[model samples]
Structures are given as C-alpha cells and as structure tokens.
Target: MKLVWTQIKNFRSIKDSGKIYFNPNLTILAGKNESGKSNILKALECFSLDKFNKDTDFPIDYIEEEYPEVIVHYQLEEDIVIDLCDTLKINKENAHKISGVTVTRTSEFLESIEVDIFKDTLEYVIDAVGEAIKVINRELKRTFKLDINSKSSYLLSDLIEKIDSYLLTIKEFFNEEQSNKLNSIIEEVVSHLEMLNGFSDYISDKKFKATIPNFIYFSSFEDIIPDSISSNEEITPIVNRFFKVVNQNPKLLFDESNPQRRRLLSDKISAGISGDFMDYYSQDSVSLKINLDGDDLNFFVYGTDTQKPFQPRQRSQGLQWFLSFYLTLQAEMKTGSVLLIDEPGLYLHASAQEDLLGMLNNLSDKSPIVISTHSHWLMDPNRLERIRLVLKVNDQTQVENKIHKGADAYTMKPIFSAIGLGLNNDISTFGERLILVEGYSDYYYLEAMRYYFQEILGIKIKKFKIYPCLGSAQIINVLTLLVDSETEYFILLDNDKAGRQTEKKLKAECGIDENKILFTPVKSKNTSVIEDMFSQKDFSEIILDSLDTNKFDKVLVSKKFNERMHNNEITILSDETVSNFKEILDVVATPKFSHREN
Candidate 1:
C-alpha cells in the first residue's frame, strides 16, 4: 500500500489546501517564511494513528461545527488486496473488483482513521448479484424466472433468500447431484452476507489500520540535539532516535563503570554513521565519535587537526545539521512510512545541500519524503513536477503546482529560483533543439503548452528546451550564442508589427532562414500575439489572478490556470483553446533542422 493523494481541511492556516498529489518519490513545498509551509507538515502528521490535539490544532478563524479533517488515499497493490480479502474472508466476487483505499482522519475530540474499503465491495456485489440472477434464470426455464435485473439491494442474503424460494419449487425436478450444487452455492453466498452483515467487525480494525500508512514527521532544525545532555533529562526526539540506534539498549551506551565496553559500543555505532555520512558528505578527513558517560552522552567530531575530538558546534552548521538529520532519520525511518522534513537544506551551502538531495533521493525509495524549504540548492532543476508552491493568499494557505505566461511576481521569482535560473550557467548548455521565446511570459505559456500536449494529449513532443530573451530586439544577442554553440534553434515570436520587423531583420540582415522562425497562432486569423491564441475568456481569467490593478502586473491569472491544470481542476475543455494550442504544437513538435549559423 502506498499513499497517493491527500487533502487537509479546517486545519491551521489552511481553510482547505485542496488535493495535493504526491510525486511518487517526494513533494517539495517551496515558499518564503511564514507562508504556512510547516503547517502542511503538521496537518499531515495528524494522519498518524489516533493522534490529535484540539486545543493546539483547532484554528481560531474556523468557528464552524466541523471536524478538522485529513483525507488520505492509498493505492493498494494487487497482492495487498488479495491478502486483505483472504484475511477478511470477503467474497471472491467483491474482492476481485477492489480499488484504492481511502482513509479519512478527523479531529473533533474523538479522532480516528475512518477507512472506506466498502466501495469495492458494494460495487462488485451489485454487479455480481445482477449477473448471478441472469444465470439462475437461464439454469431454470421451467419455473418462474427471477426478473431481478432491476434489483437494487444487491445483498447476497437477499439473493440467497430468492434463490432458496425458487429452489423449493424446482428441487423436485433436480437430481441429487444438481440439488447439492445449488444448495452449496446458496449456502456459501448466505454465509458471506451474514459475515459482512454489520460492516465486517470480524475483519478487525487493526487489520484495516495495517494497510493505512502511518506518517512520521521530523524536522532537522527544530530537533537538532544539544552536544551533551544529562541522562536524567527528558529524552528529546533526537535523543530517542539515538537510543533507537542501539535498539534502546542503554546499558552499553551509558555504562560509565566499564569504559572499554562503553567505548566499544560507541565506536561501532560511530563507525557505521561516519561511513554512511562520508558516502554523502564527501569529507574524508572528518570522523564521528560518541562518548558514553554515566551522567551524560557526549557527541564529538574528529578532525585531522588533532587526535582528540571537538564538539559538533566547532564544525560548520551544515555538518551538524547533516549529522542530526542523518542519525535521526536512519534510526526512525521505516519502510512504508512517509518522511516529512521541514527545511532539510537549512544551514547548508549549495554543494552540501545537493549532497543532502542525493541522500533524500536514496531515502525516497525507502520512505518517500515531503520536504518544505525556501532553498534553491536542494531543488532539482529538472523535476519541476516535484514542487508544490505554498503561498498565503488572503492569509489562507494555498498549495499549487502549475503556472502560465500571465503570472506576475507571485510566480516569476520563485519559479525562476525553483528552475535554478540563477544557479544554472546558460541556455547554451542544453541539447540541440531550442525554442527562443520573446520574453518570460512567452516562455511560461509554451512550457505549459508543452506539458499539456505531452501529458494530457498523450502526444510525445520533441525533447526541446524553451529559453526566453528580451523581446524581438534581443533576438540577435541570443541567436549569437545559439550560432556559436552550433545548437539547432528557432525563433518563436508574435504576429505583431515589432515581431514582423525583427523577422525581416533576421532573414535579410542576419542571414537567418525563414523556416527557422516560427510564429505563435501562426495559422490562426486575427491573432497577433501568442496570448491572442487562447480564448478571450481564458486569457482574461488567467491574467485576472495577477491581482495587478495595472494590466501588466496581473501575473496571477496565468499562474492560476497552470495551478488548475496541475491540480486537475481544469483542462483544455474549450475547443478554441485546444485549436489555438494545437496550432503552436504542430510547429514546435516538428523538427526544424535547416538553420544558417551566422
């Protein structure tokens, strides 16, 4: 069983976060501080078995008589479904039609993980009863046929009762062998109905809970442990994580009397941790050491400067952060549980953050991570699908994953950072096929369009990269780089006066080929700009979200449209929109190889 989707409602900072689809590996929640990024992690933690704190969780803004709920959907594998059916003794007919399992955890003083596996059972039972009735009618044409095609109850008990009544009149006609067959089928169906009569308490709540994943939330920054702590002090989660490493065996870890035994146990754990740390951290000279005293547990970092070790504080914060982050997760993480980390990239430089990212990728296979961060170094420039933009709009937390050309400051800066615009060297580094759009807005729309064609339309578009330039005037400046690199490229521009002027300049003055210059809405009438391709209603609505009183600043509209697409709230429903995008897609999808490098 794997957690596939989730939504949190009536929770802190979020009236409703909408449905957030996981990336199958990890979900990166990116935004600036106080954007309610951490609140997302907290809300998900509520999914942990029988856990809730009303006083702390209930938001002051929400006064409605409703439970703060977290609805989780899990995809149960065929093997898991088969096991569940066998354990629950469900009818084979019902079990065969199994679908995803949904678990809704709600807090209204009494908290519970309410599992809904009944959909599969109900769906199958209805159709199975209908089909069985047809068989019964065909089996016995002499007696009154069961006209139960319109039967709504679909209950196996109801079907058994009707079958028994029909059998009473037909048993005299059946031989002993035929009578036994009918009797056996009726007896089996009747037993299954009674077994599941009262929602299958016999299935066991524990058994159901077993399939629902338990969420384990860990924050490296918040839970970073002190260097030394008394044995009597309350065990912080970090310390508990340490205890977990030794399998909670405190004897050897705190045995001050036998120095050799304590040092021996500490060395073994330290060596294991240091080995794994080196795998990601790449600091060969550094080593990890632990000191077990009867009064306190001490952590030390060994460096080449001296044989004697120094405290973790003496090392860089990045090193300390990684140590705590690594130990805690390695000890606590279990197979099937999702890991929630808040700003795992904190205190790390670019290289170290990337090292942490590699560690996270490995851990993702074991326990998928949902990380909240404002850092760009930790982000993968390639997988924009992993990012969920957490923003506070009207003070309510909103999570989004898509954007369009009309998006303003609300999307531009973060997306640029998420895509590593600053971190990346240049567009020239990309592969052969490149599309140079006039500006940021053009780039956004084309990217969104490319995604629509590939994902929704199931059309395998070209592996092309879209780069933006400073409008028609800067086309030569960008084209110069493409020519020098010998990268095949095309100029995508508007059908306006300025674009037409630039197109002539490129062909006549720069010796550029006409075929290499593609125009948006190229085939559409009365469409000058790429924005003109979309229906007026869609273009205006997307621009409206920019919250810009001035026309140019309304960037929110495009972002909203992209978000809706990512959220699956909307798609290319408009015939005009599809026609307009398809017009552009037809050009971009095709290879334009004939380019005069000048």
Candidate 2:
C-alpha cells in the first residue's frame, strides 16, 4: 500500500493541516528554526502503532478540552491487496470496489490512540456472514413459519440453544429424511456463525495490521557508538543496533576465552562494517576494528593509509552521526516500512551534506520518506514540487501548499540548480553532463517532468544537468563548452521544420553522435512541435487557439504553464503526454551508446 495523504488536527502546534498530499517517494517539511517543522513531522509519527499520550500530543490551549487526530489515506497496490485477500479469505472480486483506504489514528476514542480503517478489505468476509444469516432466516420462515432474530438473542450459543429446542417440537411433523435435511441447513448456518465470531476476534487483535505500512521515526543521532561495553552490561539501543548490523552475538564475542576464536569474530565484524559504512561516509577510507581482548568489546577506526587505530569519538562529529543514522535505519526498518527522518545532515559540512541528499534519494526509491529540514544544502531545486513549506500563523502551525520561495537554502550561496546552470554547477563550468533543451519554456517542462519520473512514477533516472540553448542552431554553442565532458549528452528538440534542418548542423558543427539526440515524441505524428507532445485539448487551452494557430501566445502561455507546474496543478495530464517524455528519457538513460571524445 502507498501512503497518499495526511491531515492532522489539534496536535501540538497544529490546529488543522488541510489535507497535505505526499509524493510517492519523498516529501520534505521545510521551515525556519521554531516554525514547527519538526512538530509537523511528529504529528505524522503519532499515527501510532503504539500508545499516544493526550497531554504531550494535544495542543497546549486545548489540552483537556479537545482531542487530536491524525488521519492518513493509502492507495492499495493490486499485488498487496491480492496478498491480503489470500491471507484473510476475502473475495478478490469484492476487493476491486476498494482501491483506496482512509486510516484515522485518533485520541477521540480514548486517552490512547485508536486506529479505525475505512472500507477495509475484510469487509467482504464480514458482509458474506451477514448475507448468510438473512438467507437462512428467510428459508426458516418459508418452511416452519419461524424467524431467527439475532438482535433479540445476542449470543451464538443462545441462538443455537433456541434452534435445538424448537427442532425437537417440529421433529414429529417430518419423516426421518425431512428431519435430516432441516438439521443440515441449520448446521451450515452454525458454521457461518462460527466464522463470523472468528473474524470479529481477528479484528479485535488487530491481525490486519500487516496490510498497513507502519512509520518508523528517527529523530536524530545524538550519541556515537560507545568505545567499550561490558559483556553483561545492559545493551542500549545504539549498541543493540551495532551488534545487529554485524550479525554477531555481542556477549559471546566479549566472553570468549580463546584468542584465536575472538580474533576470527573480530576480523569478520571489522571487515563487514568497513564495507557497509564506507558506502556513505566519503571523507576518508576508514576501517572499523572491534577488540574482544577482555570482558569489554571496544570500537576504533583507522585510515587505510595509516593503520593507527583511533577511538570512534576521535573522528569528526559528522562522520559519527552518519554511521549512527545509517545503522539505525538498517536495524529498525523492514520491507514495507515508511521512514520519518528529522533534520538530517545537521553536523555535516556543505559538500558532505550534498552527498547525504543523494543517499536519502536512494533510500526513497525503496520506501516512502517524509524528511524535515530547514537546511538548503539538503534541498533539490528540481524537486521544488515536493516541498511543503511549514510555518506558524497566530501561534498555530500552518503548512503552505505551494513553494513560494523554492529551496530556501540557496538564499546565502545564491546556488540553486534551477537557476539555468542546473544540478551541480558554478558560473564558469556549466556542469559536465549536458542535456540541452530547445528554449527556457522547454527547460521548465522537462524539469517538472523529472520530478514526476522520480517521485510519482518511481523511475530511476540520471540527475540531468539540463541547460537550454534557446534554439536548435544554439545547440552547438553549449556543446562547444562540454567538449571533453565525462557523461552522456541529451539534445532535445521538436519534430518540426527547423528541428530537421538543425539536426544535420549538430553533427557537422559539434561532431556529436547521432544516438545522443533525444527528440520529444508527439502522438498525432502531424506537423507537430514540442508543444504538440501534450494533450490536444491542453495544448489548445494552455498554448495555441482551439482551432487557429495564429492566436499563439508564447510568453503568456509559458508563464502560465510554469506557474501551474510549480503548484502541481498540471498533474492531471494525459498518459500520452507522460509517455512522450518517458520515451525521450529512455534514450537519455541508455549508456550503451558511447559518447564521442573531442
């Protein structure tokens, strides 16, 4: 199941958050220091599989008077729904009626949080038992002028007792075969009664909890791994995670008397952590060593160049936080978990913080990540559509629907990828990996489409460094600067008159490979330009006239289109429009077509 949206009311600082939509992969809650960004994330966390405290969770003013509620909606994936139906014995045909579900975890029911599932898949099984009861009652009335009223007799045992006594009175009215047939009908009804009670017990125990993905919250990494822990000492959460990652019995490793046995376990643990931890921490080629000499298991890190082991605390604070966070994520998470990460990359420097964002993107591919951060370095300007600006109005939390500022982190450095020299670039170097669009308007459309590919569609795509060359003739001008670049090039243009004329010039002037050109496809295959790649109705409304092309307004249409794309208003687009962009991206992603060296 995919988490779609959430609404919180009277939770801490938030009085009401009006249906905040979540991106399929990632959603960032961004704001200033005390603007309640973390509080908003905490409200999401209170969709508790555990208990919720009213005093701590409810708003300060409305603590005793009001109850807080956090309601989340999920889109049921077909495969997951099928698996659930198989487990619970629900009809697959009836399951089709429910494609989405709303779950409300609220304090309204009691002091503790209560979970209510709307239009659950188990409804099919529940309703089947109800229909069976009505059918049996109808047959009884037709044959014996009797009706089984469950409301009058609440217990299944009571109903069974009443039927048993009544059957004795009617036994003389029928022959042996007729009496057996009557008993058989009642027996089938009894089976249904048992099944209904069993289902009720299943619901009371919250057995359907497997179908709903639980949120795993990690607030921060305040402590690093301990230098030494005793063999019999109570294991803290951090130490517990460390042993789990290594798949080692910490007590056995510490208590071993044989030096050789201790060395074997220690070496295996050191090598395992070094391989996994090196993937995220890039500052140094550091290796972890676990010492099992005495009752205490000690930890240390040493650079590969210099084998002198140093305590974990001796390393940079940022590296320590990175390892702590990574281990917690690996230990606490399961296959279908949703992550709630708060203010990651707080201690890291600028360059390392950027790398942390890349790691988060990789994690988002597997599970839905709702991360909160005020830091700009963690922001991706192309993914501006994913940002929900969190702030406080009249002492209550208010999350803005639109991103007006767009990557509030770039205020100091004046560095945002969307400023035209996109992705990672300065003024002089316009990034090595190039994707040249036709004009500024084409650039905006492609950038918005990249977010859709990554977050909504879950497509693995290159972090494209798109730069518009203004026109087809200007493609070579951008190519000249990236003559000896490392990555692939993508030249996007319309399938029209000027585009055909300019294609030949690209090969002659830039010495570009024919395979590098990724043309935007149009469905109609008429005299179509890049704009015609969209729906015919949308194109006529947003760009050209409904019938006549003479009333075209490029500047006005481009401005309106850009605004709508940022606000995520243009998402109700035709599948053909999305397919056109996907085809172009498919070519761009293909690395088998090698780049020509200048």
Candidate 3:
C-alpha cells in the first residue's frame, strides 16, 4: 500500500483544507525556513501516534491557537488489494441489490385490436409520406440542385406528391392476404426512422467514476520514553506496548499468555541482528545480575568495538535517529507503510547521506516516501520530479508550494550551453551531452568560443549544453543522480583550490571518469576568462582573445549600468566590470574594500 494523498485543515500555517499529492517513489518538501514546511510531516507523525493536541510541538495554528485535523488517504497495490478493500469498507462484488420491479401488463385485445384501429390507412401513409418527402426534397434541392436539373427533377418531385396523395387509397387496395406483408414493411420503416431521429443515449451515460481513498495515520514522538519504571521486569511491558502500536502487530507484543511466541522473540534476540560488518548484542543486566533477577532487558550496539551492553538512551542522537528510521522502515515494509522524514540529512555525512537516500529509494519501491529538507546536497537532479518548493505568499498564514518536474531548472541569471554560444534550456533541449560550468563568465565565453569555432574552424560544437551553477558544491549530488539515470555529465570547473576540491569530491562520490571532465589546465593558471581580460587595455585587443566576455563586460558595465548602480537602481552586481574590478582590487590590494563581507 502507498499513501496516495494527504489533506490538511487549518493546520499551523495552513489556514484551509488543502491536499498534497504523493508519488509512490518519492515526495520531497522544500521551503526556505519556517513556512510551516515541517508541519504536515509532524501532523502525520502525530496521527501515527494517535495523539494530537494544540500543545504539541507540531503547531496547528499560525494566526491563533486552533486545533487542526489531518487525514491521510491511501490505496493498496494489486497484491494487497483485498486487505485494503476490507479496511476501506469496499466490497467490489457486493453492489446494492436491485430486486424491486416495475409492473407493466397488457391483454391480447389491448395489444392487437386497439392499436390496429389506426391501421396503415391511405390517410396515415399520405400524412407521413408528405412530411418525409417535403424534408428529403427540400434537402435534395438545396444540396444538389445542379445534378437534378429542370426535367429530371420534375419526375422525382411528381412521384413524391403522387405517393403522398394516394397513401390512404392505396392501403384500402390491399386485402387480408397481403396485409400482414405490408404491415411488416411499415413496422421496419418506422423502426428505422425512430433510430435516425436522435443520437443514442449512451454518450451521456458513459463516464469514468472516481473512488474516494481510504484514511490512515502515522504518529511519532519528539521525545518518546517510558513514563514509569517500577521494576526491571516492567520494561518489557512498556517496550511491548510501544512496539505493538508502532508495528500494528496482529498479536499483542506483551501477551504473556503465549510463552511459545515469547520464546520466538527471545530466540531472535539470541541469534542477533547481524549485517556485513556488525552484530547486535544485548544483556538483561538489571534483571539477571541485580536484585530483580528476571526483570531487565538491556540492548547494546556492537560494531568495530569491544563487547559492552548499552541502553537505548545512552546512544548518540544520530544513532538513535538512524535506528528509529531503520526500525520504522522495517515495520512499514511489512504493513505497506508510507514514511515522512524531515531534515533526514541532519548529522549525516555526504557518503552516508547518499546511502540513506538509496536505502529510502529502495524501500519506496514497495511503499512511498515523503522527505522535507533544506540541504541542497540531498537533491537528486534526476529525481527532480520529487522536489517541491514551498512558499508563503501575500501573508504569513498561507503557504504556497510549487512542484517542478520538467527538464529545466530556473535561475535569475542567464545560463549558456557548454560552448558558451547558446542559451541553457535551448542546449538541454537539443544537445546530446552536457558540460556543467560554474558561473556567467564561463557560460558567456564558451558561447563566444563556440561561435568562433563554427565560423573560423568550421567545427560543429553546438551539440553540447552547459549548465552554470553558482558553485560546484552541488555538482557531486547532481552528477550522482544523473549518471545513475544514464545522463552523461562532464564537469569543467576552474582550477582554483575550491574547484579542484569539488572535482575530487565529485569523482570520489559519483565514480565519474576523469577523461569525461575537462578541468582547466594547470599551465594556464593566469589564463581564466576573467584574468585574460584584466591583462588587456583596449577592448578591441581583449575581444580578440575572448570576444564574448569583452563584449558582455563592456556593454554590461557601460554608463547606463554605472548610472543604475550609483543611483541604487540595480542591487545585485549592477555592473560586471565593477564586480570584476572589485575582485582584482581584492587580489592586488593589502586591505581591500570589498562589498561582500566574506
């Protein structure tokens, strides 16, 4: 089963009832900060726990303290259809029984003699023929007057009038011997006319019907722990209660009457939870070693370390989160569960983040996963369909979220293709390969170089798209996602320390071949697009080396731009030349007067 959709009513920043859809594979929630982005997940967690209230951390009121309710709608896959149907009160074959019947009876006299009074008389025939001929002849004349010219048309029209005028008289000419045959012909013609009168009613009745989804809930605790600890033996009952509700176990986890079942659990604990590199070790020290002998149940973690029993409370915050997520996933796999994880990348390393994402993706193959995060490192470009941007519009009360799924990524600044000649989307739409770049200058210079190569060398270099991110910090994540989906991405970052480090990280993380990436040569340390231009005086000479940058910088930093920047007309880097000049001054001067504090 999978969570198909969710509805929220007056929940925290959410003012009215609204629905958000979920894909079976992944559902990503994105927002700048506290736009109540995490509220929906928190609500689902609350519902899972079957404990929701105003005082809860999952705030259900933005303007005032209002209790809001959330409903999660779900559907089961084919294998679990029967179980789901039972849960939703659906019986596919048990439709409302239609047993009552409408009565309609007739005697032979009423059926035959009464209706026979209005026989196929000449008058009746004349009236029906007159109406039919008028319609057919009028249409014929309007449609094909040229084909049925004067003389030939006269015969057709005269015949029609004759048949209409003598219809009653002609009917009287027939005896009882031929009456039945004529009656049959008349009935057939009437039936044909009835059919032609209007369209079949089926068109209006044939339509698709929608099925309302089943409702379910998922709950979690900000701080989940036992309320009382009377004895070491009591720990089992509390743990059992929590696990029973959590896993939705058919039999109670704490059913002491079933010793055989308890033995199975004990056996499982003895065998241990072992993986490729680790094994679980547990000890009931408080029960077996201390006064309350047969009471305590102690759990421990064992991996790349010595043997020692540890309580769940003593584990690191990160470890607790991991184990909780792991157990939750396992339970969900058994019950066809949907998972909602908020800021899952918290305390996770870059490698671990990728592994966790993969694990989630794998589990999602069975159910659905909805994640909310602020980390760009968690974004998978190939899984762009799962990303959603949450925004608060007009006021602080309502949240507006937009889901992007197409092949394009939006940026305020202009982006160029790999060759720096064409626009970003144009290349992505047309090119077969891509070279991801860093910023605007690299994009502009590449476009100009592509033009030179095409014009002077007659080389076809427009077959590539160049994507310019502000930095290569997200390149590994982007490449990891795209490469797995069979998209070829080549990096062309600067040779600076940060850029080199980014390249190394990308290779280590994504296993991308070095040959595919086009790193700037080490010998050309001072040969960057920015540096190349700074070493020149006349714009004409500078244009010879990188014509695109020279033109863009000169035109972009003209008096018009200076006026706008000086008057505070444009805020973000109003003039490229001024920006570049600032960078140069920073590099040369001792204590540079930089606009950027960093």
Best by lDDT: 1
User: Which stretches of candidate 3 lie above 4 Å from their native place?
Assistant: 16-19, 45-267, 270-272, 276-293, 306-315, 394-598
- Model 1 over residues 453-536: C-alpha lDDT tens digits? 666766667777666675788888766655566567778889888888999999987899898897766444654777777788
Q: Is candidate 1 or candidate 3 better by lDDT?
A: 1
TM-score of each model, in listed order:
0.64, 0.63, 0.40
The whole-model C-alpha lDDT of candidate 3 against the native structure comes to 0.43
Summing lDDT over every window of 10 consecutive residues in candidate 1, give the lowest-scoring window.
148-157
Per-residue lDDT tens digits for candidate 2, residues 1-598, read 7777888888888899878878667788877777777876777777755345766887788856467887787766787566545645667886664556666667755221121221231233234334434444564553443454432312333444555555454555556765565665555545544444443444345545555657877767554677778877898787888887778777667768999988988898888988877787787788888887577788887887556988878988887788777777666554467888889878899788877887777777677888888676777655555667786678887876555433344331222333334334343334445578787567657776665566556567765566667688878766665666564677887788788777888877667788887676756575566676777776766434323456555533553455355545555567877777777776765542223333
Cα-based lDDT at residue 353, candidate 1? 83
Please state every model's RMSD to the true fold in angstroms.
11.6, 11.0, 23.0
lDDT-better candidate, 2 vs 3: 2
Stretches off by above 4 angstroms in model 2 are 63-65, 75-80, 83-90, 108-199, 205-207, 334-336, 404-445, 448-532, 535-598
In the range 3-76, model 3's lDDT, one tens digit per residue, is: 54566655556654356656556777765567556776766665455455555543433334444555555542
Q: What is the lDDT of residue 109 in candidate 3?
A: 11
Deviation in Å, model 1, residue 98 alpha carbon: 2.5
Worst 10 residues of 2 by lDDT: 110-119
Residue pairs whose backbone atoms clash in candidate 1: 407-555, 408-555, 542-557, 545-556, 546-555, 546-556, 546-557
